[model samples]
Target: MKCKLVDVFTKQKMSGNGLTIFYDYDVLSQNKMLSLTQEMRQFESIFVSEVLSKSSVRAKIFTVEEELDFAGHPIIGLAGHLHEESGDVNPRTWQIVLNKKSVKVKTKKSGDYFYASMAQGKPEFISILSENDKHAVLRALNLTSENLADYPLEVISTGLPYLIVPIISGIEKARILLPNFEDLLANFGAKFVYIIDIGNFEGRTWDNLGAVEDIATGSAAGPTAAYLTKHQLASVNKPIIISQGRFLGRDSEIEAYVEAKDNVITNIWISGDVAKVANIDFV
Candidate 1:
């Protein structure tokens, strides 16, 4: 199979997160996709089939460990891949029906960079974290309660659940060994903890959870935006601009806008810029 590997969320080579694309997926199988993702060993990979219907783009996103319902970088990178295969992807708005659920994605190309957006499913404010649990999370980041901003440490999800903590400054402030990482995991029932530094750098993040750092997180961003809107931490019912991944120097950006009625959030959407990389051929 011929596959194109492209980076998402940046304008230049090797800047954004990388996702490999297989334009022809007739040869695709769930087993093969999983095996190939293991072989590629990238953070994530994708396979895109020709759109059979007007409403859906046939595609699958795979991580090294498992399959994902929908992912940010893959859709952005795959949409750019399709734009090159087709022409002027102008409705630019499209939806991908994955096995998990269907999500909407849209893209626009300017010069070498392509900007894309995806509609995150309804936000789920799963739980409000406890003070000790919050302290454990703070211990992981080596920050005391005083260092973080004054906000409730909340768990939210548009797709994947994450513990979103509001912190004060850069990764320097957010990066430290988690004294009770395992306990936090056991107590919270979450795989990832995302500490978002909302004000200083717009949307810059300093993540040390999941035993590793994550480059791009679209689903997590959606619910966090909703939480911010609901708490009046950011302007409600308006698009919130967040710039992430700069602390790691990949300089990626994810912009999320929320639609809220009264105090309830109705919808959340995320947008970012991407770039196309060379296609790869595997024997």
Candidate 2:
């Protein structure tokens, strides 16, 4: 099978989150998908058994660890790739439906790059620990309670769970998180530290907590957007652009919009920027 590899979010190659898209994986098994993800050696890889439906596209996404219910970067990247090959010239809207959920991506042609927007569904904000436990979460990240933004800590989900850290508004101060490893993996049931989100504009995060540092974390960003929007800290209809992979020099940018009303997240969108880099044939 021939797989299309793309980077989601950044126009430059290798800067954004890496996504491997395989066409027609209806015959592939979960175990096969896991192996393929391992082989690709990227943060996340996606496979679509089919594409282009009336409302959306059905697909599956995989990381080195497990098959996620949904993922952000892969979905956006998939849309970008589809936007190119969809054979629908002057296409305005596209949707990619995964086994877990679905997202709608819209695009417009710029001078050289295409501007794409993905509509993430209503967020599911669940499971909040007490204030003490929340404080412990900061400790897990090697920071103090003073590091977080005002109010109680929140565990928010758009399609996944993330412990949102609102810290000092600069990446320089946000890059010092080290996991207690077990607590982060076993206790919180999440593997990403999303912050570097200071005031309203910037975001910094560390992925692959107990392992390698992820240059860009798309899955983590979804939950982050939800958390920020839920607390009345962030508003809907405003563009929230976060920078990831900067610490690693990949310098990826994840652009998303919030749709919140009355202290609730109605919808979220994470856009993808794909410029085809390499084409390869697998034997």
- Weakest 10 consecutive residues, lDDT, candidate 1? 201-210
lDDT of each: 0.71, 0.68
Instruction: Give per-residue CA lDDT, model 2, range 1-283, as digits (tens).
Output: 8778777677877667677887667888889889988898887788887656643678888878788777777777777777666545575787777766767778765443455777767766666667777776666666676666675556666676666667753445444345454355346555455665557445655444535566666666677777766666666678777777766677787777887677566777777577566665767
- How does model 2 score by TM-score? 0.84
Task: Specify the highest-lDDT model's number.
Answer: 1
Name the 10 consecutive residues with the lowest summed lDDT in model 2: 169-178
Instruction: Put down candidate 1 lDDT per residue, 204-245, tens digits, no spaces.
Output: 332333443456666667867877777677876676766666
Every model: Cα RMSD to truth: 3.0, 3.0
Return the lDDT, model 1, position 66: 71
Alpha-carbon runs more than 4 Å astray in model 1? 23-32, 38-41, 173-183, 201-211
